[model samples]
Target: MNKFELVFIPGPGIGHLASTVELANVLVSRDDRLSVTVLAIKLPNDIKTTTERIQSLSASFEGKSIRFIVLPELPFPNQSSEPPPLMLQAFLESHKPHVREIVTNLIHDSNRLVGFVIDMFCTSMINVANEFKVPCYLFYTSNAGFLDFSFHLQELYNQNNSTAEQLQNSNVELALPSFINPIPNKAIPPFLFDKDMAAWFHDNTKRFRSEVKGILINTFVEMEPQIVKWMSNGSSKIPKVYTVGPILQLKSIGVTQSNNALNGADILKWLDDQPPASVVFLCFGSKGSFDEDQVLEIARALERSEVRFLWSLRQPPPKGKFEEPSNYANINDVLPEGFLNRTADIGRVIGWAPQIEILSHPATGGFISHCGWNSTLESVWHGVPMATWPLYAEQQFNAFEMVVELGLAVELTLDYVKDFHIGRSRIVSAEEIESGIRKLMGDSGNEIRKKIKVKGEESRKSMMEGGSSFNSLRHFIDDALTNLQEGNY
Candidate 1:
């Protein structure tokens, strides 16, 4: 193939888009033969109605050698106090016609339809790929633990007694690997264990397994052999499974600078002031939020920890605000009283910080994260340790994997039930916060630093020319093209 073309799909979050964009850049740079297009597909809708539309940043991806396509125009998923998962299914049903039309066009125009390295959440595409007789590759952006956790969601739900209440009542420690302690189920994202979400996600995952070409994850096989083997060996006709990642491959291709105006957020300016390896960078992945109480609890924790920090606290507006759904909305100002003033000298708070740069700064030593996979990978990529406090989805599992399996994180848990839904207040007391912060800041800090330092080097090496990710990208194209030549498409 003289020029290879592939389409990438990402959910409506920044991390997924950032990584997908990185993948496209790397693929093109690695081969004169490759050109990749990105088709944006929102899980429910892209933004919470309260925040400013993300259009400015989204528009910047209109770059040379890359084409941007929005998942066909579809009605925004109906919003309610309902969990986001339910809204997603409703959104898909409403957009089915538009989705079908786009798929038809894509399949018709493409030459030998190579393969789709899709956000595994876009399950609807499996049908279209199969209809076109092209291979569909499940591109799992999260870690192997999440894939393993999500894979069991359907089975747990099918047990007849595993209701949301049951998952809530049970402990994750017992449900998951033996090494970690239990966390509340509600802290997990609304995506897992909810029957509707499980049905949609798992069915598509299962279909993709049965009918698509193979599984390609953004994690290396050595890092997750048990799950990888179970995946490749489980299916009767499993497509080949390839693991190569910590996918920051674009950095190797010199795709570091963003010329977009939004880069003016100037996060690096703030980082320059902090002492080397002294600031704990705190930010949950975009799309994550905390309840009022959790917000105050974090404020108290940070204040008590007395660790210099840079924090980004951006949460979706409470469900009721979506009723009016306008651009300028009452979103920020969620932090607690005297919180900003008390910590002003010790920490910097922003709506959103340029994360990669902030995490990479020499002044940044550790992270207090929600354990979102991309954040986990990015922190590891930059050689930073974490204070793992997961709040949702399979993140709880990733936290476990990091602390128990990888030894790269210090798991901080507040193992108690919260009275309210968004969980701002239900956290460790001020004392625990102080201790947790200290553990990651001093001599213990250097020890954790050494462990993660090697990981960053390994992560970078894995995507370089002779690396696993580099070679895997090559194999991906050749396999798809050769299969197409044999009349697969």
Candidate 2:
């Protein structure tokens, strides 16, 4: 019999691509009869970097049953002005014909195309899956709480007939389900302020969940049980939910320099010099960069905090462009005078530090992160606490849950609009940054460390045989098999 082949469509970024590949790896590893074909989507402005990262991930899976096929980059119509949600929607919508063709050919060849596992951004593939008469599953790359929040917002909007402007501007303290405390408007995603994009996303999520077979979240039940419970309560249109993750195990590259642009030895050597759990690794996600003023303040904060640090800093994005510049300028140009030299003994600054490798190192203790879901999970997996600095997307919600609900991180700032690039004169002051770092690195962080340490153990256990996440995946596979035998596909 032919192996069960599943098609996975990932959104356009390293985080989405990496997590999707990891999930695929888990699927095939769990069952020899399973195989996955990842359909990579190219992002608009950052095509080169994105493709390079995807290629690296594919190479890492060399002997594995997973394969990658990249889709063409979406053509930008008025690319200068379009937001991410709209750009993503356009890309997925425009590529529907291509996806349909691919699926049709696979069916014609009699491949055991059991299901379509698609990224949340690529929900447009649901129609193509329906057309091909296969089950479609949504793979959410973030925490379950973020997923619940999106649906809750949608439900609230629907029930209240609230305008996007009113909802965005309202100082409503919501006691939303799936969370322990009330959620403030400032902790919501900044895109909600954009009336059109917010409406589009809300409607798309509602349709996507209602239309798909189920959702596979990249989270374990132990990490966010409340949120997972809320998601699986069957109140939403999504029929089933699976928590089969903390699934970010990158195959060993075997003693070479890490794939990030920086040298692995240099990063490791610096960490080696520090005491265990003493150094803080700072990195925003792929798209994270700071303005000159914010950069200087970070330098000042690092200097004042007197904590050992490694910063993976980036230049701010070019105007009307979302990608990093091909070349980097000197840090001296942006940092305060004598800041780097004075902190040289305690801090190491580099561009694009190998985040996962560094996080796994014993010398690394805390993370000052953008709270991107991928980073958050990595931090937890390594048993490291975080100083949360959410930049964009659902990161603010992730930070809120980490700090307020899960008790895993310290907050630098939770204001959603403050860190955004659009005409914001306020910079998070050096004093406040220094204070947050001190709190994270000091004895006060002991409880958070203990909590995350237990979580790390639970994360590992969840993937073991008979564990919650392990059983969840097994159940999903069995259900798919039953449906196949019943001719449901």
Candidate 3:
């Protein structure tokens, strides 16, 4: 049997790395002639956790034709004043030479280097892939709706020379093909309000259009049918688009033997005591955290709602530090006085969450989420409806999609951007939080719950043989093999 090798370069974040690794597992499992080598990038902070997770994935897939190789850590950049998007682009650019060296050795060892599957943030590595005469595919960690919005923004920049300042200053709604309703200006990603970040996104979108052989999105057709249909249509401006996902781990990873394991067991046991579909799960993504004021509001809301709940509350990292939010040393220090005791019988609060396990539990009725793409997919996979409280990145847009387009969630605050110096620009009041929680857990949520239950069934079916995502994966693999036969790489 002839052998083919593909190199994967995932972003430094855990969410990005996990999805990329899952995609690699899908590829090698489908085709015995193919193998994947993942080049893991080291994040400056939380190096230990990332390393351990990678180790765990490797161990879980022992004897598989997948390899995990950690790249040497580069010195942290000194440009503190630069916008974060530019800083990240420069940091990844510094890895080009290291990547070239590794790819060179892989080829010299008689491996038929076919392609490079790179994270969306690691687009700088595309130049290296070009140098090695291999095709490059972008593994977009977000949904197709967000990808379409990005392309729309880039088109506006190209055709009308629109600037971030102009977009931020105007209050116009955009009627993009990807969405059913006109997207309001407030729904745009907060990062795009900065001039430097807007330009960075424009450049990245240009590369996505002109450089990549294909773009792989982490969404299934049933989730975003209209947007997927629009992109997959024969369009000259867009590259080949593949929707091969709901690509997530079904079981929990990297928590079996750590402190988290004990915590996870307790949380699961607590859930076991609750009746089926009785608990509302509130968890923000890894970077999601809040100030004392916001935390107090959530606590009050949970108490007033009187619903069984599991809340994962994390403390923000100290100012001027490049670190993730840590579990509160004592969660009570920030929460309302006597709040834990008052809600003891009905709810539990913890630091880090074993999200997959919690969502899969029969007791989980609804999710109060930050609307991260990974969390959104996981919620759908487990048939849990959501209430959106988006904080950063493209989450605001995702919230709009869930509430307006798909009707899969209720809205808490679609455009809540956290200000590091202070708190949110406008604090979401406790009453508002309580209203959302009640709606999500009460009879008002029946319609949304039914929609999500059906969507969740479709999500699973999409991964089965002869389903949309399964066929999409087969199509992607066929294209890669065809390129190899044609000597196009």
Cand. 1 Cα-lDDT: 0.63
| Tens-place lDDT digits, model 1, residues 289-341 | 55656667777878877889877666555564332111112323566766767
Off by over 4 Å in 1: 42-64, 93-96, 103-112, 152-197, 225-238, 249-266, 320-339, 414-425
- Write one digit per residue (lDDT tens) for candidate 3, span 269-334: 999999999999999998898888888888888998999999988889887655689877677699
What's each prediction's TM-score? 0.81, 0.94, 0.97
Off by over 4 Å in 2: 161-163, 235-237, 251-262, 324-327, 416-425
Q: Which window of 10 residues has the lowest lDDT sum in candidate 2? A: 252-261
The regions of model 3 sitting more than 4 angstroms off are 256-262, 419-423
Clashing pairs in 2: none
* Per-residue lDDT over 149-215 for candidate 2, one digit per residue giving the tens place of the 0 to 100 score: 7877888778765546765655777677668898887777777767777788788778755788778
Among all candidates shown, the one with the greatest lDDT: 3
Q: How many backbone clashes does candidate 2 have?
A: 0
Q: Alpha carbon lDDT of residue 69, candidate 1?
A: 64
- Ranked by TM-score, the better of candidates 1 and 2 is 2
**True-vs-predicted CA distance for residue 62, candidate 2, Å:** 2.8
